[model samples]
Target: MRVLVVGGEATIGRHVSAELRRRGHVVVTAGRSSGDVRVDVRHRDSVADMYREIGGVDAVVAPAAHGTTDRLQTLSRDELLQNMQGKLLGQVDLVLLGQHHAAAGASFTLTSGIFADEPWPGVTGGAMINAALHAFVRSAALELPRGMRVNVVSPTMVGDSVDSFSSTFPGMRPVPMDALVTGYLSVIEGERTGEVVRAYG
Candidate 1:
């Protein structure tokens, strides 16, 4: 199978890409940096260009996004939009535009986080975007044509990176990146759609 993994430069995206490649699938990993192609999820044109370059693939996985980490009061409207633009809306656009370029029955797996259901002070933007993305996947699943599938993977902070987000993720259990990749593989290979698979819970 051919897979296009967006934001494959670091963290979960990197692991997901490597795992897919290890499984003997043809994987094209893309990020803002050098790759087979460049994709800024914030822009629809960039997503389109990536598909154009890769031609059609069997699946698209997005494991990267950006968002503000400030409290709601400190978050400017622009900061909120920045999160929505890159993480929420951009991934949505990826699916909407991807339908045109993906092979029939193609699968799309998006990334969300524990914030969708869990609460953390100073993480209002992430919470909002994560919840919205799950909603988008549910609705998109029903309307997608030609057996295409859409799903969201909501993972908790990685156990390996707990130190970097210690302040924000106080007391939260970090799931390993390898564990989270299981959710991605589930979405890609299973016949499921419209589901938000939580890696921790």
Candidate 2:
């Protein structure tokens, strides 16, 4: 399968891209500063341009998004909006615009995180965005055209980032990057849609 992986420079994204390659799938990585193609999901024009450049693909995987980690009290309205624009709508718009550019049976695998269910202090913005993405996938799956499929992968803190987030996620067991990548693989390869494939350890 020919795959386009957005945010493919990140740790999880890299793992997903490599694993797909190992399985004999052709993978194209796209991101703002890295990857084979440049795309800033926060901008609709950039996303549209990306799809135009790539034409058609079997799958589009987004393994990264941005959200604020500041305390609720310190977060301004603009910050919250930025978080929503960058993580929630940014990813949703990708699917909305890429649908026409995707192949007949193309699939979209979006990324959320364990925060949707397992909330932590200073991450309310991320939690809300993750929850919203889950909801979007559930509803969008029912209305997608041409047999297109959409799913979200909600993973716990990955082992690769545990050192940095360990204090924030104290006592939480981090899932290995490999294990989390499997959640994405399942959505890319499986027929099930509107599902939240959880990779919580």
Q: Best by lDDT, which number? A: 2
Candidate 1 per-residue C-alpha lDDT over 108-200 given as tens digits, one digit per residue, 9 for 90 to 100: 999888888998888888998999999999999999999999999998888768889867768888898788888899888889999999998
Tens digit of lDDT per residue, candidate 2, span 1-89?
A: 99999988888888999999999999999999998999988888999999999889999999977565878888778888888887899
Clashing pairs in 1: none
Give the Å shift of residue 167 in candidate 1: 2.9
Which stretches of model 2 miss by more than 4 angstroms? none
Question: Which candidate's TM-score is highest?
Answer: 2
